[model samples]
Target: MSSHLLSRPLLLRHLPSLSFPLSNHRFRPRRLSSSAAVRPPATPEPAVSVAISADERYGKKQIISVTPQIYEYILSNVREPPILRELREETSSLRGSQMQVSPDQAQLLAMLVQILGARRCIEVGVYTGYSSLAVALVLPDSGILVACERDARCLEIAKKYYERAGVSHKVDVKHCLAVDALNSLIQKGEAGSYDYAFIDAEKRMYHEYFELLLKLVRIGGVIVVDNVLWHGNVSDPLVSDPRTISIRNFNKKLFEDKRINISMVPIGDGMTICRKVLQY
Candidate 1:
Protein backbone atom coordinates (compact mmCIF):
# COMPACT_ATOMS: atom_id res chain seq x y z
CA MET A 1 0.00 0.00 0.00
CA SER A 2 1.18 3.51 -0.74
CA SER A 3 1.88 6.00 2.09
CA HIS A 4 -0.88 8.25 0.64
CA LEU A 5 -3.52 5.51 1.02
CA LEU A 6 -2.31 4.61 4.54
CA SER A 7 -2.59 8.24 5.70
CA ARG A 8 -6.37 8.29 4.96
CA PRO A 9 -8.15 5.74 7.22
CA LEU A 10 -11.69 6.85 6.12
CA LEU A 11 -10.77 6.36 2.41
CA LEU A 12 -9.18 2.94 3.19
CA ARG A 13 -12.40 1.66 4.87
CA HIS A 14 -14.45 2.21 1.63
CA LEU A 15 -11.85 0.51 -0.64
CA PRO A 16 -12.86 -2.70 -2.49
CA SER A 17 -11.30 -6.05 -1.52
CA LEU A 18 -9.35 -6.11 -4.79
CA SER A 19 -5.96 -4.59 -3.99
CA PHE A 20 -4.30 -2.00 -6.19
CA PRO A 21 -0.60 -2.75 -6.64
CA LEU A 22 1.84 -0.12 -5.26
CA SER A 23 3.45 0.13 -8.72
CA ASN A 24 0.10 1.20 -10.27
CA HIS A 25 0.72 4.96 -10.51
CA ARG A 26 -2.63 5.51 -12.28
CA PHE A 27 -4.61 4.64 -9.14
CA ARG A 28 -2.33 6.47 -6.69
CA PRO A 29 -3.82 9.51 -4.94
CA ARG A 30 -1.46 12.47 -4.72
CA ARG A 31 -0.17 13.15 -1.19
CA LEU A 32 -1.55 16.48 0.07
CA SER A 33 0.73 17.71 2.85
CA SER A 34 -0.05 20.72 5.08
CA SER A 35 2.94 22.54 3.58
CA ALA A 36 1.85 21.97 -0.02
CA ALA A 37 1.23 25.19 -1.93
CA VAL A 38 -2.12 25.73 -3.72
CA ARG A 39 -2.33 27.81 -6.90
CA PRO A 40 -5.18 30.27 -7.34
CA PRO A 41 -7.19 30.14 -10.61
CA ALA A 42 -5.97 32.52 -13.38
CA THR A 43 -7.83 35.75 -13.91
CA PRO A 44 -8.78 36.77 -17.46
CA GLU A 45 -6.36 39.19 -19.15
CA PRO A 46 -7.56 42.81 -19.59
CA ALA A 47 -6.37 43.07 -23.21
CA VAL A 48 -9.39 41.20 -24.58
CA SER A 49 -11.83 43.55 -22.84
CA VAL A 50 -9.76 46.57 -23.83
CA ALA A 51 -9.81 45.51 -27.50
CA ILE A 52 -13.59 44.91 -27.42
CA SER A 53 -14.19 48.29 -25.83
CA ALA A 54 -12.01 49.97 -28.44
CA ASP A 55 -13.92 48.27 -31.27
CA GLU A 56 -17.23 49.43 -29.80
CA ARG A 57 -15.96 52.98 -29.39
CA TYR A 58 -14.51 53.27 -32.89
CA GLY A 59 -16.68 50.92 -34.96
CA LYS A 60 -15.14 48.23 -37.16
CA LYS A 61 -11.71 48.83 -38.69
CA GLN A 62 -12.13 49.95 -42.30
CA ILE A 63 -8.69 51.12 -43.45
CA ILE A 64 -5.08 51.09 -42.41
CA SER A 65 -3.93 54.46 -41.02
CA VAL A 66 -1.55 56.12 -43.50
CA THR A 67 1.14 57.69 -41.36
CA PRO A 68 3.25 60.64 -42.57
CA GLN A 69 6.32 58.47 -43.13
CA ILE A 70 4.29 56.09 -45.26
CA TYR A 71 2.82 58.96 -47.29
CA GLU A 72 6.32 60.38 -47.81
CA TYR A 73 7.52 56.99 -49.01
CA ILE A 74 4.59 56.77 -51.43
CA LEU A 75 5.32 60.26 -52.81
CA SER A 76 9.01 59.44 -53.19
CA ASN A 77 8.22 56.44 -55.35
CA VAL A 78 5.69 58.24 -57.60
CA ARG A 79 6.93 59.79 -60.87
CA GLU A 80 5.59 63.32 -60.40
CA PRO A 81 6.69 65.40 -63.40
CA PRO A 82 8.30 68.85 -62.89
CA ILE A 83 5.28 70.85 -64.10
CA LEU A 84 2.96 68.76 -61.94
CA ARG A 85 5.22 69.20 -58.92
CA GLU A 86 5.22 72.95 -59.52
CA LEU A 87 1.45 73.06 -59.94
CA ARG A 88 0.90 71.03 -56.77
CA GLU A 89 3.30 73.21 -54.76
CA GLU A 90 1.62 76.40 -55.98
CA THR A 91 -1.83 75.05 -55.18
CA SER A 92 -0.73 74.18 -51.63
CA SER A 93 -0.79 77.86 -50.61
CA LEU A 94 -4.25 78.56 -52.06
CA ARG A 95 -7.52 78.40 -50.13
CA GLY A 96 -9.35 75.07 -50.53
CA SER A 97 -6.03 73.42 -51.38
CA GLN A 98 -7.43 70.22 -49.93
CA MET A 99 -9.71 70.02 -52.94
CA GLN A 100 -6.81 68.88 -55.11
CA VAL A 101 -6.13 65.16 -55.40
CA SER A 102 -2.95 63.72 -53.92
CA PRO A 103 0.07 62.76 -56.05
CA ASP A 104 -0.54 59.04 -55.65
CA GLN A 105 -4.19 59.43 -56.66
CA ALA A 106 -3.13 61.44 -59.71
CA GLN A 107 -0.77 58.62 -60.65
CA LEU A 108 -3.59 56.11 -60.32
CA LEU A 109 -5.91 58.26 -62.45
CA ALA A 110 -3.23 58.68 -65.12
CA MET A 111 -2.63 54.91 -65.13
CA LEU A 112 -6.36 54.27 -65.47
CA VAL A 113 -6.54 56.65 -68.47
CA GLN A 114 -3.64 54.80 -70.11
CA ILE A 115 -5.19 51.41 -69.39
CA LEU A 116 -8.52 52.43 -70.90
CA GLY A 117 -6.78 53.94 -73.94
CA ALA A 118 -8.95 56.90 -73.12
CA ARG A 119 -9.14 59.54 -75.88
CA ARG A 120 -12.15 61.56 -74.72
CA CYS A 121 -12.28 62.34 -70.98
CA ILE A 122 -14.44 64.55 -68.76
CA GLU A 123 -13.53 66.09 -65.40
CA VAL A 124 -16.47 67.48 -63.40
CA GLY A 125 -14.45 69.36 -60.78
CA VAL A 126 -11.06 70.54 -61.91
CA TYR A 127 -9.71 72.20 -58.78
CA THR A 128 -6.40 73.74 -59.99
CA GLY A 129 -6.07 70.81 -62.48
CA TYR A 130 -3.73 68.33 -60.72
CA SER A 131 -5.77 65.30 -61.75
CA SER A 132 -6.64 66.74 -65.18
CA LEU A 133 -3.00 67.52 -65.89
CA ALA A 134 -1.94 64.02 -64.81
CA VAL A 135 -4.54 62.42 -67.09
CA ALA A 136 -3.70 64.75 -69.98
CA LEU A 137 0.02 63.94 -69.70
CA VAL A 138 -0.66 60.23 -70.26
CA LEU A 139 -3.16 60.75 -73.08
CA PRO A 140 -2.12 60.55 -76.73
CA ASP A 141 -1.49 63.81 -78.62
CA SER A 142 -4.96 63.65 -80.21
CA GLY A 143 -6.78 62.96 -76.90
CA ILE A 144 -9.03 65.64 -75.37
CA LEU A 145 -10.05 66.26 -71.72
CA VAL A 146 -13.15 68.42 -71.21
CA ALA A 147 -12.75 70.20 -67.83
CA CYS A 148 -15.73 71.78 -66.01
CA GLU A 149 -15.21 74.30 -63.27
CA ARG A 150 -17.25 77.36 -62.18
CA ASP A 151 -14.41 79.04 -60.32
CA ALA A 152 -12.54 81.34 -62.70
CA ARG A 153 -9.53 81.83 -60.44
CA CYS A 154 -8.96 78.11 -60.09
CA LEU A 155 -9.50 77.64 -63.80
CA GLU A 156 -6.91 80.32 -64.60
CA ILE A 157 -4.35 78.52 -62.45
CA ALA A 158 -5.21 75.23 -64.12
CA LYS A 159 -4.88 76.85 -67.58
CA LYS A 160 -1.45 78.22 -66.68
CA TYR A 161 -0.25 74.72 -65.74
CA TYR A 162 -1.85 73.20 -68.82
CA GLU A 163 -0.06 75.75 -71.01
CA ARG A 164 3.23 75.11 -69.20
CA ALA A 165 2.82 71.35 -69.70
CA GLY A 166 2.06 71.95 -73.44
CA VAL A 167 -1.25 70.10 -72.96
CA SER A 168 -3.43 73.22 -73.38
CA HIS A 169 -4.57 72.02 -76.84
CA LYS A 170 -5.88 68.81 -75.28
CA VAL A 171 -8.03 70.50 -72.58
CA ASP A 172 -11.33 72.29 -73.22
CA VAL A 173 -12.30 74.35 -70.17
CA LYS A 174 -16.06 74.82 -69.59
CA HIS A 175 -16.67 77.84 -67.36
CA CYS A 176 -20.15 76.89 -66.17
CA LEU A 177 -22.04 74.76 -63.73
CA ALA A 178 -21.07 71.12 -64.31
CA VAL A 179 -24.70 70.10 -64.77
CA ASP A 180 -25.25 72.80 -67.41
CA ALA A 181 -22.04 71.82 -69.20
CA LEU A 182 -22.93 68.12 -69.14
CA ASN A 183 -26.48 68.93 -70.31
CA SER A 184 -25.09 71.04 -73.16
CA LEU A 185 -22.92 68.15 -74.27
CA ILE A 186 -25.94 65.80 -74.31
CA GLN A 187 -27.93 68.39 -76.25
CA LYS A 188 -25.17 68.42 -78.88
CA GLY A 189 -25.60 64.68 -79.46
CA GLU A 190 -22.38 63.88 -77.52
CA ALA A 191 -23.95 61.26 -75.28
CA GLY A 192 -22.19 57.91 -75.04
CA SER A 193 -19.05 59.39 -76.64
CA TYR A 194 -16.73 59.95 -73.66
CA ASP A 195 -14.33 57.18 -72.63
CA TYR A 196 -13.78 58.34 -69.01
CA ALA A 197 -15.28 60.74 -66.45
CA PHE A 198 -14.22 61.83 -62.96
CA ILE A 199 -16.65 63.41 -60.49
CA ASP A 200 -15.36 65.47 -57.55
CA ALA A 201 -17.91 68.25 -57.34
CA GLU A 202 -20.67 69.36 -54.95
CA LYS A 203 -21.59 66.65 -52.42
CA ARG A 204 -25.36 67.22 -52.57
CA MET A 205 -25.52 66.80 -56.36
CA TYR A 206 -23.44 63.60 -56.70
CA HIS A 207 -26.45 61.62 -57.87
CA GLU A 208 -27.23 64.25 -60.50
CA TYR A 209 -23.64 64.22 -61.70
CA PHE A 210 -23.67 60.42 -61.73
CA GLU A 211 -26.91 60.28 -63.74
CA LEU A 212 -25.67 62.89 -66.21
CA LEU A 213 -22.25 61.25 -66.57
CA LEU A 214 -23.89 57.86 -67.05
CA LYS A 215 -25.46 59.26 -70.21
CA LEU A 216 -22.21 60.91 -71.30
CA VAL A 217 -19.77 57.97 -70.91
CA ARG A 218 -20.01 55.11 -73.40
CA ILE A 219 -20.78 51.51 -72.51
CA GLY A 220 -17.76 49.88 -70.77
CA GLY A 221 -16.51 53.39 -69.95
CA VAL A 222 -15.41 54.16 -66.36
CA ILE A 223 -16.52 56.88 -63.95
CA VAL A 224 -14.31 57.56 -60.94
CA VAL A 225 -16.12 59.19 -58.00
CA ASP A 226 -13.92 60.89 -55.40
CA ASN A 227 -14.50 61.50 -51.69
CA VAL A 228 -16.85 58.51 -51.48
CA LEU A 229 -15.63 57.74 -47.96
CA TRP A 230 -15.72 61.41 -46.90
CA HIS A 231 -12.72 61.07 -44.60
CA GLY A 232 -14.05 57.81 -43.10
CA ASN A 233 -17.25 59.55 -41.97
CA VAL A 234 -19.57 57.51 -44.23
CA SER A 235 -19.11 54.37 -42.09
CA ASP A 236 -19.74 56.11 -38.75
CA PRO A 237 -23.34 56.10 -37.55
CA LEU A 238 -22.63 58.93 -35.12
CA VAL A 239 -21.67 61.24 -37.97
CA SER A 240 -25.05 62.56 -39.07
CA ASP A 241 -23.64 65.62 -40.87
CA PRO A 242 -25.43 66.45 -44.10
CA ARG A 243 -22.47 65.63 -46.36
CA THR A 244 -21.69 62.41 -44.52
CA ILE A 245 -25.30 61.25 -44.67
CA SER A 246 -25.46 62.12 -48.35
CA ILE A 247 -22.30 60.10 -49.06
CA ARG A 248 -23.54 57.12 -47.01
CA ASN A 249 -26.82 57.09 -48.90
CA PHE A 250 -24.95 57.48 -52.19
CA ASN A 251 -22.69 54.52 -51.40
CA LYS A 252 -25.69 52.33 -50.61
CA LYS A 253 -27.38 53.42 -53.83
CA LEU A 254 -24.28 52.52 -55.85
CA PHE A 255 -24.02 49.10 -54.16
CA GLU A 256 -27.66 48.26 -55.08
CA ASP A 257 -27.48 49.68 -58.61
CA LYS A 258 -27.24 46.87 -61.20
CA ARG A 259 -26.41 48.93 -64.27
CA ILE A 260 -22.75 49.23 -63.41
CA ASN A 261 -19.98 47.11 -61.85
CA ILE A 262 -18.31 49.01 -58.98
CA SER A 263 -15.25 48.89 -56.73
CA MET A 264 -14.69 51.31 -53.84
CA VAL A 265 -10.94 51.82 -53.54
CA PRO A 266 -9.54 53.01 -50.17
CA ILE A 267 -6.90 55.32 -51.61
CA GLY A 268 -6.87 59.08 -50.76
CA ASP A 269 -10.19 59.69 -49.01
CA GLY A 270 -11.72 56.96 -51.24
CA MET A 271 -12.68 56.56 -54.87
CA THR A 272 -15.50 54.48 -56.34
CA ILE A 273 -14.56 53.11 -59.77
CA CYS A 274 -17.74 52.27 -61.66
CA ARG A 275 -17.68 50.58 -65.06
CA LYS A 276 -20.91 50.84 -67.01
CA VAL A 277 -21.93 47.27 -67.86
CA LEU A 278 -25.56 47.81 -68.96
CA GLN A 279 -27.03 50.61 -71.01
CA TYR A 280 -30.41 50.43 -69.31
Candidate 2:
Protein backbone atom coordinates (compact mmCIF):
# COMPACT_ATOMS: atom_id res chain seq x y z
CA MET A 1 0.00 0.00 0.00
CA SER A 2 1.24 3.46 -0.93
CA SER A 3 0.47 6.78 0.81
CA HIS A 4 0.46 8.32 -2.67
CA LEU A 5 -3.27 7.68 -2.88
CA LEU A 6 -4.22 9.72 0.22
CA SER A 7 -1.75 10.63 3.00
CA ARG A 8 -2.86 11.86 6.41
CA PRO A 9 -1.16 15.26 5.94
CA LEU A 10 -2.62 15.76 2.45
CA LEU A 11 -6.08 14.66 3.62
CA LEU A 12 -5.92 17.05 6.59
CA ARG A 13 -4.81 19.94 4.36
CA HIS A 14 -7.75 19.41 1.97
CA LEU A 15 -10.36 18.81 4.70
CA PRO A 16 -12.74 21.76 5.27
CA SER A 17 -13.24 23.37 8.71
CA LEU A 18 -16.57 22.27 10.21
CA SER A 19 -19.16 24.10 12.35
CA PHE A 20 -22.38 22.48 13.50
CA PRO A 21 -25.69 23.99 14.64
CA LEU A 22 -26.88 23.37 18.23
CA SER A 23 -29.97 21.69 16.78
CA ASN A 24 -27.69 18.94 15.24
CA HIS A 25 -27.11 17.24 18.61
CA ARG A 26 -27.04 13.74 17.09
CA PHE A 27 -24.15 14.64 14.79
CA ARG A 28 -21.88 16.00 17.60
CA PRO A 29 -18.65 14.14 18.43
CA ARG A 30 -18.59 12.19 21.70
CA ARG A 31 -15.67 12.92 24.03
CA LEU A 32 -13.79 10.01 25.62
CA SER A 33 -13.43 9.88 29.41
CA SER A 34 -10.01 9.67 31.16
CA SER A 35 -10.68 6.06 32.23
CA ALA A 36 -11.78 5.15 28.67
CA ALA A 37 -8.95 6.96 26.89
CA VAL A 38 -8.44 6.54 23.14
CA ARG A 39 -5.85 3.92 22.24
CA PRO A 40 -2.59 5.09 20.64
CA PRO A 41 -2.36 4.67 16.88
CA ALA A 42 -0.69 1.43 15.86
CA THR A 43 2.54 1.43 13.86
CA PRO A 44 2.14 1.57 10.12
CA GLU A 45 3.01 -1.45 8.03
CA PRO A 46 6.03 -1.26 5.70
CA ALA A 47 5.26 -0.74 2.05
CA VAL A 48 6.39 -3.48 -0.35
CA SER A 49 8.59 -2.09 -3.09
CA VAL A 50 8.39 -3.55 -6.61
CA ALA A 51 11.13 -3.25 -9.23
CA ILE A 52 10.17 -3.33 -12.88
CA SER A 53 12.75 -4.90 -15.22
CA ALA A 54 12.65 -5.79 -18.89
CA ASP A 55 15.92 -7.76 -18.83
CA GLU A 56 15.21 -9.89 -15.79
CA ARG A 57 13.45 -13.24 -16.10
CA TYR A 58 10.04 -13.30 -14.35
CA GLY A 59 8.92 -16.03 -11.99
CA LYS A 60 6.11 -18.48 -12.74
CA LYS A 61 3.34 -16.77 -10.78
CA GLN A 62 4.83 -13.28 -10.62
CA ILE A 63 2.15 -10.73 -11.48
CA ILE A 64 1.01 -7.19 -10.77
CA SER A 65 -2.13 -5.11 -11.26
CA VAL A 66 -1.45 -3.18 -14.49
CA THR A 67 -2.93 0.29 -14.25
CA PRO A 68 -2.49 2.55 -17.29
CA GLN A 69 0.32 4.37 -15.47
CA ILE A 70 2.06 1.12 -14.65
CA TYR A 71 1.74 -0.06 -18.25
CA GLU A 72 3.21 3.21 -19.49
CA TYR A 73 6.05 2.96 -16.98
CA ILE A 74 6.86 -0.56 -18.16
CA LEU A 75 6.87 0.48 -21.82
CA SER A 76 9.14 3.44 -21.07
CA ASN A 77 11.71 1.34 -19.17
CA VAL A 78 11.54 -1.83 -21.28
CA ARG A 79 14.32 -2.20 -23.86
CA GLU A 80 12.73 -2.52 -27.27
CA PRO A 81 14.95 -2.18 -30.33
CA PRO A 82 14.09 0.28 -33.10
CA ILE A 83 12.96 -2.38 -35.61
CA LEU A 84 10.69 -4.02 -33.05
CA ARG A 85 9.25 -0.68 -31.97
CA GLU A 86 8.49 0.20 -35.58
CA LEU A 87 6.82 -3.17 -36.17
CA ARG A 88 4.72 -2.79 -33.02
CA GLU A 89 3.56 0.65 -34.09
CA GLU A 90 2.62 -0.62 -37.54
CA THR A 91 0.57 -3.48 -36.16
CA SER A 92 -1.20 -1.44 -33.46
CA SER A 93 -3.74 0.08 -35.87
CA LEU A 94 -5.04 -3.11 -37.51
CA ARG A 95 -8.66 -4.30 -37.10
CA GLY A 96 -7.60 -7.30 -35.00
CA SER A 97 -4.65 -5.58 -33.40
CA GLN A 98 -5.85 -6.78 -30.01
CA MET A 99 -4.72 -10.26 -31.04
CA GLN A 100 -1.10 -9.05 -31.15
CA VAL A 101 0.87 -9.81 -28.01
CA SER A 102 1.87 -6.91 -25.74
CA PRO A 103 5.44 -5.56 -26.02
CA ASP A 104 6.28 -6.92 -22.57
CA GLN A 105 5.03 -10.35 -23.54
CA ALA A 106 6.91 -10.19 -26.86
CA GLN A 107 10.12 -9.24 -25.06
CA LEU A 108 9.66 -12.14 -22.69
CA LEU A 109 9.22 -14.50 -25.63
CA ALA A 110 12.44 -13.25 -27.21
CA MET A 111 14.28 -13.67 -23.92
CA LEU A 112 12.95 -17.18 -23.52
CA VAL A 113 14.19 -18.14 -26.99
CA GLN A 114 17.70 -17.00 -26.10
CA ILE A 115 17.61 -18.42 -22.55
CA LEU A 116 16.57 -21.83 -23.86
CA GLY A 117 19.30 -21.69 -26.57
CA ALA A 118 16.51 -22.52 -28.96
CA ARG A 119 17.55 -23.31 -32.56
CA ARG A 120 14.19 -24.40 -33.97
CA CYS A 121 10.91 -22.86 -32.80
CA ILE A 122 7.23 -23.17 -33.62
CA GLU A 123 4.61 -20.44 -33.31
CA VAL A 124 1.01 -21.76 -33.39
CA GLY A 125 -0.64 -18.44 -34.31
CA VAL A 126 0.98 -15.74 -36.41
CA TYR A 127 -1.21 -12.66 -36.10
CA THR A 128 0.78 -10.08 -38.11
CA GLY A 129 3.97 -11.88 -36.87
CA TYR A 130 4.47 -9.75 -33.75
CA SER A 131 5.51 -12.76 -31.68
CA SER A 132 7.20 -14.40 -34.63
CA LEU A 133 9.26 -11.28 -35.21
CA ALA A 134 10.21 -11.10 -31.57
CA VAL A 135 11.43 -14.68 -31.43
CA ALA A 136 13.15 -14.58 -34.82
CA LEU A 137 15.06 -11.40 -34.01
CA VAL A 138 16.68 -12.98 -30.95
CA LEU A 139 17.48 -16.35 -32.50
CA PRO A 140 21.01 -17.33 -33.59
CA ASP A 141 22.12 -17.24 -37.21
CA SER A 142 21.15 -20.90 -37.73
CA GLY A 143 17.83 -20.56 -35.87
CA ILE A 144 14.49 -21.01 -37.66
CA LEU A 145 10.87 -20.35 -36.71
CA VAL A 146 7.97 -22.30 -38.20
CA ALA A 147 4.95 -20.01 -38.01
CA CYS A 148 1.57 -21.68 -38.46
CA GLU A 149 -1.38 -19.45 -39.30
CA ARG A 150 -4.60 -19.71 -41.31
CA ASP A 151 -5.33 -16.07 -42.10
CA ALA A 152 -3.76 -15.00 -45.36
CA ARG A 153 -4.43 -11.30 -44.86
CA CYS A 154 -2.70 -11.31 -41.49
CA LEU A 155 0.18 -13.34 -42.90
CA GLU A 156 0.68 -10.76 -45.64
CA ILE A 157 1.07 -8.01 -43.05
CA ALA A 158 3.37 -10.27 -41.00
CA LYS A 159 5.54 -11.05 -44.09
CA LYS A 160 6.02 -7.33 -44.80
CA TYR A 161 7.12 -6.66 -41.22
CA TYR A 162 9.26 -9.79 -41.04
CA GLU A 163 11.11 -8.66 -44.17
CA ARG A 164 11.47 -5.17 -42.73
CA ALA A 165 12.90 -6.64 -39.52
CA GLY A 166 15.45 -8.62 -41.65
CA VAL A 167 14.23 -11.91 -40.19
CA SER A 168 12.25 -13.09 -43.22
CA HIS A 169 14.72 -15.90 -43.94
CA LYS A 170 14.40 -17.22 -40.38
CA VAL A 171 10.59 -17.44 -40.34
CA ASP A 172 8.83 -20.15 -42.38
CA VAL A 173 5.25 -18.91 -42.67
CA LYS A 174 2.74 -21.75 -43.25
CA HIS A 175 -0.51 -20.28 -44.48
CA CYS A 176 -2.85 -23.07 -43.33
CA LEU A 177 -4.67 -24.34 -40.27
CA ALA A 178 -2.25 -24.74 -37.34
CA VAL A 179 -3.30 -28.35 -36.79
CA ASP A 180 -2.45 -29.34 -40.36
CA ALA A 181 0.96 -27.69 -40.16
CA LEU A 182 1.72 -29.33 -36.80
CA ASN A 183 0.65 -32.74 -38.11
CA SER A 184 2.76 -32.26 -41.19
CA LEU A 185 5.80 -31.59 -39.03
CA ILE A 186 5.19 -34.84 -37.16
CA GLN A 187 4.59 -36.79 -40.33
CA LYS A 188 7.86 -35.52 -41.79
CA GLY A 189 9.83 -37.08 -38.89
CA GLU A 190 10.28 -33.67 -37.22
CA ALA A 191 8.91 -34.83 -33.87
CA GLY A 192 10.96 -33.92 -30.85
CA SER A 193 13.16 -31.72 -33.05
CA TYR A 194 12.09 -28.28 -31.83
CA ASP A 195 13.43 -26.59 -28.73
CA TYR A 196 10.44 -24.31 -28.07
CA ALA A 197 6.82 -23.83 -29.09
CA PHE A 198 4.40 -20.94 -28.55
CA ILE A 199 0.64 -21.54 -28.66
CA ASP A 200 -1.69 -18.59 -29.39
CA ALA A 201 -4.22 -20.01 -31.83
CA GLU A 202 -7.98 -20.72 -31.57
CA LYS A 203 -9.17 -21.08 -27.97
CA ARG A 204 -11.26 -24.20 -28.59
CA MET A 205 -8.25 -25.96 -30.17
CA TYR A 206 -5.82 -25.30 -27.30
CA HIS A 207 -5.95 -28.86 -26.03
CA GLU A 208 -5.41 -30.23 -29.51
CA TYR A 209 -2.47 -27.90 -30.12
CA PHE A 210 -0.95 -28.69 -26.74
CA GLU A 211 -0.97 -32.41 -27.48
CA LEU A 212 0.66 -31.90 -30.86
CA LEU A 213 3.23 -29.40 -29.56
CA LEU A 214 4.26 -31.74 -26.75
CA LYS A 215 5.20 -34.30 -29.33
CA LEU A 216 7.02 -31.72 -31.44
CA VAL A 217 9.23 -30.34 -28.66
CA ARG A 218 12.00 -32.53 -27.25
CA ILE A 219 12.36 -33.54 -23.63
CA GLY A 220 13.31 -30.53 -21.42
CA GLY A 221 12.00 -28.26 -24.17
CA VAL A 222 9.54 -25.46 -23.31
CA ILE A 223 6.04 -24.67 -24.58
CA VAL A 224 4.35 -21.39 -23.76
CA VAL A 225 0.56 -21.05 -24.06
CA ASP A 226 -0.81 -17.52 -24.35
CA ASN A 227 -4.23 -16.12 -23.36
CA VAL A 228 -4.73 -18.82 -20.73
CA LEU A 229 -6.81 -16.34 -18.68
CA TRP A 230 -8.98 -15.47 -21.69
CA HIS A 231 -9.37 -11.90 -20.42
CA GLY A 232 -9.96 -13.18 -16.84
CA ASN A 233 -13.10 -14.98 -17.96
CA VAL A 234 -11.85 -18.49 -17.11
CA SER A 235 -11.92 -17.76 -13.36
CA ASP A 236 -15.38 -16.20 -13.38
CA PRO A 237 -17.92 -19.01 -13.00
CA LEU A 238 -20.68 -16.87 -14.45
CA VAL A 239 -18.82 -16.50 -17.75
CA SER A 240 -20.01 -19.61 -19.56
CA ASP A 241 -19.14 -18.38 -23.00
CA PRO A 242 -17.60 -20.93 -25.41
CA ARG A 243 -14.07 -19.47 -25.24
CA THR A 244 -14.27 -19.13 -21.45
CA ILE A 245 -15.37 -22.73 -20.99
CA SER A 246 -12.67 -23.92 -23.39
CA ILE A 247 -9.91 -22.08 -21.49
CA ARG A 248 -11.22 -23.22 -18.08
CA ASN A 249 -11.32 -26.83 -19.15
CA PHE A 250 -7.92 -26.51 -20.83
CA ASN A 251 -6.39 -25.17 -17.63
CA LYS A 252 -7.85 -28.03 -15.59
CA LYS A 253 -6.45 -30.57 -18.02
CA LEU A 254 -3.01 -28.93 -17.92
CA PHE A 255 -2.99 -29.05 -14.11
CA GLU A 256 -3.81 -32.73 -14.12
CA ASP A 257 -1.26 -33.45 -16.84
CA LYS A 258 1.84 -35.24 -15.45
CA ARG A 259 4.06 -35.34 -18.52
CA ILE A 260 5.29 -31.79 -18.11
CA ASN A 261 6.19 -29.35 -15.31
CA ILE A 262 3.78 -26.42 -15.62
CA SER A 263 3.79 -22.83 -14.45
CA MET A 264 0.77 -20.61 -15.07
CA VAL A 265 2.40 -17.21 -15.32
CA PRO A 266 0.34 -14.03 -15.01
CA ILE A 267 1.68 -12.00 -17.86
CA GLY A 268 0.03 -10.59 -21.01
CA ASP A 269 -3.38 -12.33 -21.02
CA GLY A 270 -1.89 -14.92 -18.61
CA MET A 271 0.73 -17.22 -20.19
CA THR A 272 1.04 -20.86 -19.12
CA ILE A 273 4.54 -22.33 -19.53
CA CYS A 274 5.02 -26.07 -19.78
CA ARG A 275 8.38 -27.86 -19.82
CA LYS A 276 8.32 -31.35 -21.29
CA VAL A 277 9.97 -33.75 -18.85
CA LEU A 278 9.08 -37.08 -20.44
CA GLN A 279 9.39 -38.75 -23.79
CA TYR A 280 6.26 -39.75 -25.73
All candidates: CA RMSD (Å): 23.8, 16.0
TM-score of candidate 1 on Cα atoms, chains taken together? 0.77
> In candidate 1, residue 122 scores what lDDT?
99
Alpha-carbon deviation at 116 in model 1, angstroms:
0.2
Q: What is candidate 2's lDDT per residue for 6-62, written digit by digit as tens? A: 221111110011111132132222345788764644974333224455654654443
Q: Stretches of candidate 2 above 4 Å error?
A: 1-64
Write down the TM-score of every candidate. 0.77, 0.77
lDDT of 1 by residue, 1-280 (tens): 4455433211221112112222212222234556764443397322111112347677765543444324444445667777876787788788888788877788899999999999999999998999999999999999999999999999999999999999999999999999999999999999999999999999989999999999999999999999998867787799999999998999998999899999998777789999999885
Clashing pairs in 1: none
Task: Kindly give the stretch of ten consecutive residues in candidate 2 with the minimal lDDT sum.
Answer: 9-18
